[model samples]
Target: MGIEWAEPGSSGHVLEASMRPVDSLQHSRATPVRARMWKFSLPLRHPETGRLFADIDHLGAGLQRRSIDRYMWLIHDRDEGSAPHVQGALRLSNSRTSTQLSSILGLPSTALRPLRDRSGQHGAFERYCRYLLHESPEAQADGKFHYPDSAVHANFRFRDMIDRYFGLADSGCVPTAESADQIRLKVYNGDMTPLEVHGRHPMIFIRNHKSIEELYYKGRHDRLIAAALAERAALKDEDARVPSTDPHAA
Candidate 1:
């Protein structure tokens, strides 16, 4: 779905302030145009009941996880639409047993030494048994999904993602016209060139099992490295612009 614009003090206005991504917002507060947009993956469909469910959930309190169960549709872009990249869209799914549980639960920052190590570790079956037997009566009585560990983990990840995704190179500073122009040039240069015509229907193309695996492992790593490099460049530029107060400033 495209971005939803909300008026200040309107019924759905709560999210508008945080979702803004454009510099023009400050100059014209009364404008109705959207300053930013977020891309959300299309829903996963069920074959039995023909119901659709979102693949990703952005539950506000730092908890974001792919749906535990859903069917994903793979479409092939044989017509060169996905040129620079070999694929169209890939859906990420998360399982309850995934090893990422601990970080998600905020165990790393907890003050309790004993419980910190156990929250998100692979010894889930053991942990569950331990909680059932040794945990305080109040914690044991709470539901599994809403338990203190799970709640803390979700909030931790949510806040971290917000900072990573929405934060600018410098805090409390709007982007300058020159910097905005540079960003536009990068967008134009870095993006995949558009195709003149739509490619083959996804059903017609055959799938390569090996390519998919390579994309997940090698391609994903390469993209992450590129993102790191971009962030480093931005930080370096920001550092260079600081005015030196002392002549001997290093």
Candidate 2:
């Protein structure tokens, strides 16, 4: 048997096959499974009123009922003229075929892209979690910090899900509150490494691209910095040679 549902702005039909209840799949210990990670952007919030367009809890519950392995999500506030939206990552379990996964999620197969790390340095899921939690240096430099308590509606559930899925035993690495000036001092004085700074303050880090670049390739940061300086000098010389745009100027 199959069930069909229509989604707004979707032209193709969606069919979900009747499968065995997902509850039967749960066990005392979560089995090692081939997990697929996905990122989704949903129009499930109001831009102006800061209201949710749909019941987020209900949506999460539905996903849980459908046997999703784990997820972490947040409602992003409108920024720089963009509308507010819900952004999230989904980890699907049970080794279901991609087609079945698409059917379960009620999304077109084309839209269900599995996240992967192109650089092969880290797992896509881990990198994405770091990005979303503002743990990555890039995210820290971007200055768009997302606090789990304020940004995520189901923060507790998300934490529990992550801990369970990763088998993480809390190391008591809670961040201590620090003023901006204090953070700046700690980061700039070479008192601590980038990872150490991140451990203490996951949401804020002074832009230290060199430290990040050094992690992957020792001494590459200096070469890249020199190359950038050369490029800037060349651009300045090019600009100097250009004819003046002002008609009244000498």
Candidate 3:
């Protein structure tokens, strides 16, 4: 409810994830030798009835939208946490209808032009209407997904959030340590401090929305920038580890 949307996996911040800030994770305490845990059970009192009817039919996939919580719970039996959902969450807004649907989805509209601008992860974009009209919920139904509009428009802004959340930066296209050290050395030799250096990076700017300490992740650009800077600094450190080639010594 804090940041959850009225619809499942719809537009809005994920409530669960927001509650626990990433900064706190870095300073988590070690587990206790033994901690007391308790369990409790509550009984649900319903009206007098011989049996309860299962709503399996009402549960299957159709066009029913609920808050992300109810939806993730239905799929994984656990919460996937919440994400920020802005107005861009809904692509069908009356005013934004004219906006390029492809851009919103983070894909070039012309990229699939030969196919008539058709899109569907599992093939639903063009066939969406067809599915709704012909495919009954019972006979055959498919699910369609779209990225948050903010990502398409302001991807750089959420770079930190995306990288940390997905853990892709560490293993994926990262700059070498030498590169990181070089960046750090450059920043140090320049007229800027660490804080200033971070400020200048595109990634930092994106994550440093309201405050630098408590930054909100907008996308992956931040990770890329940070990695590059880090690699430069690491490079400089490597160079320093060995003695400089001295003409007077062997």
Q: Candidates' TM-scores?
A: 0.18, 0.41, 0.15
lDDT of 2 at 4: 28
Residue-by-residue lDDT tens digits, candidate 3, 134-232: 222222233333222232322122323332322222233332222223334444344334465354443322322233322223223465678899999
Task: Encode model 1's per-residue lDDT on 40-159: one tens digit a residue.
Answer: 122122223444322222222223334312111121112122211010111124332211322332211110111122345432222222232222234434422212222222212222
Local error of candidate 3 at residue 164 (angstroms): 7.2
- Per-residue lDDT of candidate 2, residues 1-250 (tens digit): 1222223223323333333234324421344333367765444433334444444555566466446767677765533333444556667665444355554555333233466667744456655654555534455566655444356643235443333322222233443444434544544554555677556544343333344324424334555887899999999999999999998998
Worst 10 residues of 3 by lDDT: 37-46
Query: Using lDDT as the measure, which candidate wins?
Result: 2
The worst-scoring run of ten residues by lDDT in candidate 2 lies at: 1-10
lDDT of 3: 0.28
Candidate scoring better on TM-score of 1 and 3 = 1
Model 1 alpha-carbon miss at residue 140, Å: 53
Candidate 2's C-alpha runs over 4 A off are: 1-35, 45-58, 96-111, 143-145, 153-250
